[model samples]
Target: MPRSKRDKKVSLTKTDRKGLAWKQRIIDDIRFCVEKYPNIFVFQVQNMRNNLLKDLRQEWKKNSRFIFGKNRIMQIGLGRTKAEETETDLHKLSKRLTGQVGLLFTEKTKKEVLEWAENYWAVEYARSGFVATKTVTLPAGPLEEFTHSMEPHLRSLGLPTKLEKGVVTIYSDYTVCEEGKVLTPEQARILKLLGDPMAKFRLTMKCSWTKKDGFELHVEDSVDDNQSDSAMEEEPEDDDEKEEMEGDDE
Candidate 1:
């Protein structure tokens, strides 16, 4: 008698197995970097901008390495306890790897790295959920910067705009958004169109782990390890962040 088709076992696809393989690859890479580099720094990113970060990575590609995402996987590679640690005092560095943080492995001196981080920052267009830094108001009359076709779009964003002759115009002074309020999608898009950037991307050095001296605290730990892991892959920070092999960046 022939067996039923439902009795046949389905084979797992590459994608089904990718999660474990990806995690293992990241773990191995972290451990490998630990051996290759003498200094490892824990850093937190504020207002992360993917383009700006990619550019910074390209600039530092020659000497430094950055490992981001999967904080737990990184912790496993670095070791979470004294016995499991890859190196002496590495577990301490792993302990502080909570929140939106990444590892920087480099050969640069502590002073040099710290000084560079102090001055490194980029102004970027704010995305949805960010708080408006300042109030924006468009005065009554023709808005020459915008074309007549954009009048509909501006009005849709709650700008109260119309086309006067061939130009987008506002009959009365229009307030786009108020300061200190969380920005909606429309407000963010409008701000971007108006060339107003409210987000600043900056890196803050949290702590450092060195080969000779072991772990040294640069900034006091403010984040809780037990904090909700729901934001581990922060949605608002970078929409396109993904895993890449050492020489191949995304």
Candidate 2:
């Protein structure tokens, strides 16, 4: 039997489906963090190393939480222009999440986090096309580690090499790269071959936010390293003296 028009259910239209489902999920995640942690920090990374990051998560599992991926969604979750949306100061962190940045919700104080970021470092092979931080020079001597067959490949990297009785020998000191110079394919390959790792992995506490401090950016400024930049300007004092007396005493 056909139902009456008033009895029919209202169907959702395209406008109802305008937003992705995950956006709400991200918002909920951000809200949960606000309820759970006292302070939050943001970190920007030059590259991603899954194993190392996983280890860090395990180590800080007791006191910290790491949120990565879907940065834009998370940014919107925190609030963009105003704090009224989230009803918290989390919005202040949105501006600094422009690049590959992640959220760190932690019970630990800001000083502890910043110290770890400044001191904790890892060394890894420098990728091709990155600038060489230092010069890689191979002295004129017998390269007993490499066989004679590798002579051609070594010379291809611009090293003056010759095979002497089935051994690769460098005729003179060969400079593979210069400091502050963009490394070429050959230079990177030779550096790795020589087991000279130049790249140092480091993290910076780009910024942080909290209830008492509001928002702070860890930039080089007049403030000392021991101080946090989150202190906002003092709010106007309430002129209660000019107001008429009201309710009863407690």
Candidate 3:
């Protein structure tokens, strides 16, 4: 009994296949950077913002390259062990790629990169669940800043806001957020409306690898030697770990 053409099932899972291709492309690109650039620095981003990073990439497009992707894929790119590492002591650098980090392959000197990163930071709105940096209290009074129509939306966000005499007003002293506290969705929204941003997107230099210096840790506690040294298994891409190729040759 031959199955009918319409009865045959077609596989729907191409995510894994696409992820592998993306990973391999990253690995190849990393290796290529190793050949093209003389130095590589692994840096951690405090608050990830694609727009800020994209701007930096454009500015350094000629002299530097940045790669942001899954840690496991990046580890495989530079190799996870001495025997497999693409460059000398890069395995040590690979171990430090443990958090929300990215690689900067560049021709710039180590001092230049360190100085730039130390002073570079951007302030942006904090999202829900972010720890508040400072307490923001709105005194009970007319919120003349907002339009009367915005009273309902403000009230829905847990604000004691109302329309009074064609003005939005708060009945009582409202604490939008408190320092050392995790923000709720409503609190975060209110803070944004009030133009109070809590998140500081900054890059901290973790470590750097060069042919002359090998692996050097710029920041203390960048990588724990006691942590697992086992090679990271290959992982499929997700929304967070999507491929980011900036200033790559390709």
Q: Pick by TM-score: which candidate is best?
A: 3
In angstroms, give how far residue 237 of model 1 lies from its true place.
15
Model 1: runs farther than 4 Å from truth? Answer: 1-18, 222-250
Lowest summed lDDT across 10 adjacent residues in model 1 is found at 231-240
lDDT of candidate 3 over 166-222, digit per residue (tens): 999999998888999999999989988998888999999999988778789988874
Give the CA lDDT, 0 to 100, for residue 29 in model 3. Answer: 89
Work out the TM-score per prediction: 0.82, 0.66, 0.85
Better of 1 and 3 by lDDT: 3
Worst 10 residues of 3 by lDDT: 230-239
Better of 2 and 3 by lDDT: 3
Clashes of 3: 0
Q: For residues 125-173, could you state the per-residue lDDT of candidate 2 as single tens digits?
A: 7778788999777899899999888899989888899988888999998
- Against the reference, the lDDT scores of all candidates come to 0.80, 0.69, 0.84
lDDT of 2 at 219: 56
- Full ranking by lDDT: 3, 1, 2
Which lDDT tens digits does candidate 1 get at residues 1-250? 9998889776666347448777898888888889988899998888876566677777787888888756777788998767788798787788787767888888888889999999988899998999889998889988898878888888998887877678888889988789999999999999999999988999999999989888888897664444433433322423225333242322
